[model samples]
Target: MSVFADLHRGDEPLLLPNAWDHASATALAAQGFRAIGTTSLGVAAAAGLADGASATRDETLRLALALGSQPYLLSVDAEDGYSEDPDEVAEFARELACVGAVGINLEDRLGSVALHAAKIAAVKSAAPDLFVNARTDTCWLGDGDGDGDGEETTARADAYQRAGADGVFVPGLTDPADIAALVERLHAPLNILYTPTGPTVPHLADLGVRRVSLGSLLYRRALGAALEAAAEIRAGRAPHGATPSYDEVDALSRRGDLTHSDGP
Candidate 1:
């Protein structure tokens, strides 16, 4: 199995942190995260594009090309494969794999089950080695306790798995009972989106979650910190939090040089 795929089989759930750019990804790697994922929201917000609207395909590819040769593994958040057509989605997945991405996240957005399954199959056919984490937004795009939605979620997850997904992701699934039940039904590893109000990482692991993703949480926190720092400065007070030195920040930009033997 690939190194990225092996991460899902480990004893502890893979705590995958999402990064918005090269600096964020490198910084996370410096902190010892072996794998990093790109958040669609962060990418869209940075480029002033709409998230989940399939508008950042080129930008996503550019970022993947930049970080593909880095030391750590990369899993891109390719929202709905950036297109409805399965072949186009497969082509995009192939491009991501070519750029060194070891995995890709494709969300269904509670859309057609057959269509999403076709996309998953196509992606696997196109990039056989790329780990496809098939995501179903049944719980994500809705609200409530999700009392009677478990069957629907399981059905969709099952379909994706049959379509050749390496793993299954349910973004808004948090309830312990619900998660454990889903995990029991899934043939593939289960990935849960980490939330502050939800079960802790250890708890999720105990519940049989193979992976935990902090989707957009880090990016949102970084933005919050920047806003707070600016507010404090305007108020004539020093900003709070652990701020990296200017040189440290500069060093991240230069870190890319180490990737190539000859300097750019």
Candidate 2:
């Protein structure tokens, strides 16, 4: 396993936060997060588009180019490889690899599991060095665990693993037992989406999960915070949280480089 893959093997599942741009990614890396992921929703929203619907290919690439030279490991959330055609998806994978991304989260949210599987295989074939975290959406869209248990969750994850996925992700899973069972059945590493009700990092590690992704959770929360701050200010009330200084953000963007007269 690659060091990135090895990081997920510990009892503590790696907690991967998704960033939308260079500054967000650099900030997280500065905070000592060894691995950072890109959020499709954030990228799509920033481009005035919808996510998980095959939009924002160029925008995703633009963001990748911006993030490629950052000092942290990057995993990109490229929804369905942005096409149904396997060849195109594989080419996309090659491009992500060229940009120095260490991981890619490819999902089957739009149906056509076989096509998604082909995409996964193609990405792995083209970029053997990149970690391919395959995602199955049975619980996110189907009737998995109508009673809210995790049994049905395992079946879906298993299917993806059988298709040659390095790891399987279930975005809407929350129950701990369900998570543990899914981990048990999933031969490949299991990745769960983090929810307020879901197991925390330590709890997930105990459940045998290898990875936990924030998905669009952070981006949505940031949007929520922005709305709340604006509302509070409009209501003549002070914001209720600590805010980062402009200097801090500028530093994340490497102001020293911009101010330099010599080549970096």
Candidate 3:
């Protein structure tokens, strides 16, 4: 079994924190996280691109390459595989595998279901070692999980699994019953985005969810904090909360260089 497969069989669900850059990833790894994920929203926002719109392909690859050599597993959020062509997506997955990324999240986003399935199959065909986390936006896009019409979450998940996806991700799914049903039915790992209103990690683990992704929630919160702090400074007020020192921040963001030795 792969690392992801082993994680699913563990007693607790893998609480994955999505990182926006090398600094965030390294900081999380330093804090004892075994695996780190790249957030599409953070990458897009930082590059003045839009998330879920298939932009920032190169930016995502670059970020993956930067995090690849780090001493932790990397899972990238490749929005729709950056193309509708399954072969292109598969080739991209192969490249990511070459860079040492162990997993990737590919979203449907209410697009062609068949196309998504094809992408899943292609990635599996190209890089059997890479964990393909197929994402369905049924809850986030149109109708909720309870609604009858539109892309049904269960259907998409089932199809993805049959198409060779290693896992299925459903964001905006908060109901424990719905989560449990998906987890029970899907042979592959079931990953849910951690929502503030949804069940906690322990509760999700009990419900049989294999993974819990922080998604863009952390990134958005970080941005919110920065904006608030800047506003306070502009207003001649001291910034609230404890901020890391410049050196600490630098260290958190550093990527180990092989050309130089730190010895005397």
Candidate that would win on lDDT: 1
Prediction 1 global C-alpha lDDT: 0.92
Select the stronger candidate by lDDT from 2 and 3: 3
What are the per-residue Cα lDDT tens digits for candidate 2 across 201-247?
78888888888898888889888998999999999999987678877
List candidate 2 segments past 4 Å from native: 143-156, 255-264
TM-score of each: 0.95, 0.90, 0.93
C-alpha root-mean-square deviation, candidate 1? 2.9
Model 3: residues with Cα > 4 Å off, grouped in runs: 144-151, 257-264
Model 2 earns a TM-score of: 0.90
Candidate 2, RMSD to the unseen true structure: 3.3
Give the per-residue lDDT digits (tens) of candidate 1, residues 1-264: 999999999999999999988889999999999999999999999999999999999999988987888999999999999999999999999999998999999999899999999999999999999999999887888775542388899999999999999999999888999999998998899999999989999999999999999999999999999999999999999999999887676667564445433332
Candidate 3 at residue 231, lDDT? 100
lDDT values for all models: 0.92, 0.80, 0.87
